[model samples]
Target: MVIFGLTAVVVVGGGAFVAKRSYDNSKIVPTPITPEDFGKIALGDLYAPDPKADAYKAAAVTAYKKDKLKNARKGVAALDWIEIKDKGPGGDGFPQANFPPGSNPSPGSNKGVAKTMLSSFGFGAEQWGCLEKLWMKESGWNERAMNRYSGAYGIPQSLPGSKMASAGSDWQTNAATQIKWGLGYIKGRYGTPCGAWGHSQAKGWY
Candidate 1:
C-alpha cells in the first residue's frame, strides 16, 4: 500500500510539472518597439511637435491682437473630424494696398482675428491652416478686399458687402465684424472652417 501511494503521488506531480511548462510556453510575449517603428507609423500617429505649424499659430494670434479683435462667448459644438491638407496658395496676387489708409495690409493684418473667430466657433488649432488658406484664397484677409467680379467684399467677402450688417453695423470697417459674420456663415453652411475650406477647395468657393 505504501509503494502504491508513492507511485500515485509521483504521477500527479509529473503531470502538474508538464502542464505548468506547457502553459508557460504558451504565454504571449510583446514585441519591443524599435526606432524603425516610428518610420512605419503614420504621421498623425506621432505626437511630435511641428515648428512650422506652431509658427503659423503664433502669427495668427499676433494678427488677432493687432486687429484688436474680441472673442465671442460661444464656441463651436463638437466636431466629428477636421481635415487639413495642402500648403495652400499664398496670398501673393492680392494687392498690397492698405485699408483705412494707415491700417495694415491684407494677409498679414487679419491672421489672429481669423484664428480667434474660428476658435469662438468651436474649431481647434489644427483648423487654423485650412481657415488661413481658405480666406487667403477668398479675400486675402483684407478688410477692404473687394471682389469686383463677384461683388463680394471685406475679409469674409460678403456678397454686396452689406450682408455682413447682421453681424455688426461696422462690418465695412471692422475686421472683427466681418470675421464674426464669416464665422457665422461658415458655421451655418459648412459646419466648421475646415468644412468650408474643404468646399472652397473642391468647388472654388465656400
Candidate 2:
C-alpha cells in the first residue's frame, strides 16, 4: 500500500511539472489567438491620431501569421491607414497645403503635374519613367481611384482617404493634393520614385 501511494504521488507530481512548464512557455511566446478573439475582428482603416492603432495591428498580424486569424488584411489595413493619416494637415512635421485663396485650382487632368513634382524632387527622366510606371500600375494617376479590396484611395493610395487632408482640405476633389501626398510618401519611404517602383515590382505592392 505504501509503494502504491508513492507511485501515485510521482505520477501527479510529474503531471504538475509538465503543466507548469507549458504555462511558463506560453508566457514567453505570444498568446495563441482563439476563435473568440477572431470573432471580434471587423477590419477597417483607422485614423492616425489614435496612438494604439499600430500596436494593435502589429499584434493582429502576429496572430494572423500564427494561423489564428482568417486573413492578414486586418494587419495590412492597419499599416496603410497610419501611413496616410500621418500626411494629414498638421501631421507631425509634414507640410500643410495652405494655398492662397483660389491659387489652387481644380485639376482637369493629372497630366504634367506628376512630372513637375518629379523634377522638384531632383529626379530626372529615368526616375520619372519609373514613377510613371509605378503610379500607372497603382492608380493610373487617377486622384479618385480607390482600391475596392483594401479601401485605399487616391493617387498615392492613402488608406482611409481622410489622411490626405494634410496635403489639402480638397483631397477628395483635387489631383494636386493626392500628388503632393504621394510624393511625400515616396520621398520618405523609398528616398526616390525609382526606389518605390522597385519595391512595388518585387513585393507586388509598394
The candidate maximizing TM-score is 1
Lowest lDDT block of 10, candidate 1: 80-89
Q: What is the alpha-carbon lDDT for the whole of candidate 2? A: 0.53
Stretches of candidate 2 exceeding 4 Å from the true structure: 1-108
Per-model lDDT: 0.53, 0.53
Write down the TM-score of every candidate.
0.50, 0.49
- For every model shown, the clashing-pair count is 5, 2
Model 1 ranges off by over 4 Å: 1-101
RMSD to the true structure for each prediction, in A, is: 26.7, 18.3
Candidate 1: the clashing residue pairs are 60-112, 64-112, 64-113, 76-121, 76-122
**Local error of candidate 2 at 200, Å?**
0.5
